[model samples]
Target: MAGRFDGQVAIVTGGARGLGLAIARRLAAEGAAVVIWDLDLTGFDADKTSFRPASAVKVDVTVPEAVTAAMDDVRSSFGRIDVMVNNAGITGPVAPVEQYRLEDWLRVLALDLTAVFLCCRACIPHMKAQGYGRIVNVASIGGKEPVPGICAYGAAKAGVIGFTKSIARELAGSGVLANCIAPAMVETALLGQMTPRFVEESRNKIPLGRFITAEEVAAAAAFAASPECSFATGFTFDVSGGRATY
Candidate 1:
């Protein structure tokens, strides 16, 4: 699997850092010409990376126009989009449903669920035209387990899982596969948003008694977004450290 992506083009949304960055790096290492889409380019340093990406474009995935423009840029520059990793998202305020604000909920879904949809909608045509593609959407364990105090985040991620399932069904026998990754609180900047108690309680829930790492997630994503993963679609690759068994 060393050069699983050689001669292919891959796009990683919100890939400037954290889980996205890790996945982007892995795809590049496997020989994919990786391109990242993010509002911030602070964490993406081409020269400092082990596997330098083809480019990092500043695109706000939440905006349909921006996403379309960026996809065009990628296609114009790289020729084809072989893989798309929807990794951009945020863990909305850690508050109970009763305390959650409507604005916060809207914001969460806009980036988490809606953005995934927009990116998929924008790229599927390109992939369909080429007759081959792999779509790996980053979901969360909160979508599987009923985690309280984060209604928006949980609901949005659940939507991603459901959305991915439908995408796979629609693309069946179409040379394109869609899957999701449900990770249980990986130790990335995502943790910084949570309260100390929130992080510890989540850790205790995992039988492994620890949070998963970004590199571990990247490894799993590499396979899901690789051509080697040809048979599985509408599946969830869990990196929950025993928090989720199904």
Candidate 2:
């Protein structure tokens, strides 16, 4: 069957599990030949699904050299990168600002903020040259509102939102669109890093009375990276499920 992404190539970061994995699968199902960049590739086999990534390359997104090399490899193999999903992230030690460790803060920012920069930096040129591209950064509702204990996470995601806007404007007429998803508390493995009390409190705050799902996020991301998303750049698509009043 023909699909929106037929004959296109996509690259999803941190796709070994959780949100990244779900998004990767969704892109593949839509007929985009996908590539996964992660530290682990155990989840994606050559025949895992009717549509799967052409290659699941092991990558450490925090490292500049590795990200550059991986991006280059994908371009060399596919001739173009139509979609770049910066979905790799970590919620560093969920604690108050005063209790957060310096290392934890830096680590979270490195993976969450800086890695997004690295991937976008590597992809912008290829996209510009082709005159088309979609960069969907997975931000968080915590970035827009206050999530209290997860100071580092909130800060990093806020940066992603701002960064997406900046780049979207920069590439506005250049044929590349940049946007982000600000979803509320998603019950993924990432939740395992948070305190049970913290999780409970977060769930209670949601007006919908439930957390987000990986599949829901994936669907939103797919739209942001689709040709139909042509007019909505520099925007934050709220997947907060009624939690965000703004």
Candidate 3:
């Protein structure tokens, strides 16, 4: 039997590691030609047997020109763009709002929020022309609720939710669907940087009492990108291990 995403083409930003890598792997396993876009090119193995040799492209999503060039390259190589996962993001500094530096805050916003806009702006036109597209953006539980010590990261993710909703409405008539996923304290390398106390606190707060695996998030992403995900644009899927009741 053929995979669900057979013949589809997908681009996953920050696909080198963490949640992005898991999503890329899942999409590829489902028979989509996958392009792993990231800044760090070291040891980034794109499983060629699963997808179309898994193109590994170095891209900084915050830079519009770079994003355009990367997308163009994907288009040229893949022949069509069917799905995009905006998963590149950074948690800058852990500080109170009063102690947050302007530069640090700006950097977080640029990467976490602005880059999503840039990618969507560059890719939506092609998707519109084809009359089919699926966009899955990675936000966080902090986007919906309060998360202290990471104000900039939280705010940027919240912006992603709003931006995705607006664009989802605009493109609903054109056969392109946009959605965002909000996960809380998933098991990624980035989580290692969190203070032990914070980690423990987060785990305790989760009703499941455990950190969500990257594969869990990947499953949600795959569903959102699937053709069966019709009539669900502008929605937010929660993968917060029951931490988010909304």
The lowest-lDDT stretch of 10 consecutive residues in candidate 3 is 45-54
Candidate 3, residue 114: Cα displacement in angstroms equals: 0.3
TM-score for each predicted model, relative to the true structure:
0.98, 0.96, 0.96
Q: What C-alpha lDDT does candidate 2 achieve relative to the native structure?
A: 0.91
Candidate 3, 7-93: lDDT as tens digits: 999999999888898898889888898898898868565454233336888899999999999998888888899999999998877
TM-score rank order: 1, 2, 3
lDDT of 1 at 4: 87
Error of 2 at 13 (Å): 0.5
* Local accuracy of candidate 2 as per-residue lDDT tens digits, 128-239: 9999999999999988986888888899999999999999999989999999999888878989998999999989888899999999999999999999998999899999
Candidate lDDT (C-alpha), each:
0.93, 0.91, 0.90
Q: Highest TM-score: which candidate?
A: 1
Give candidate 2 regions above 4 Å deviation: 43-51
Order of candidate numbers by lDDT, starting with the best = 1, 2, 3
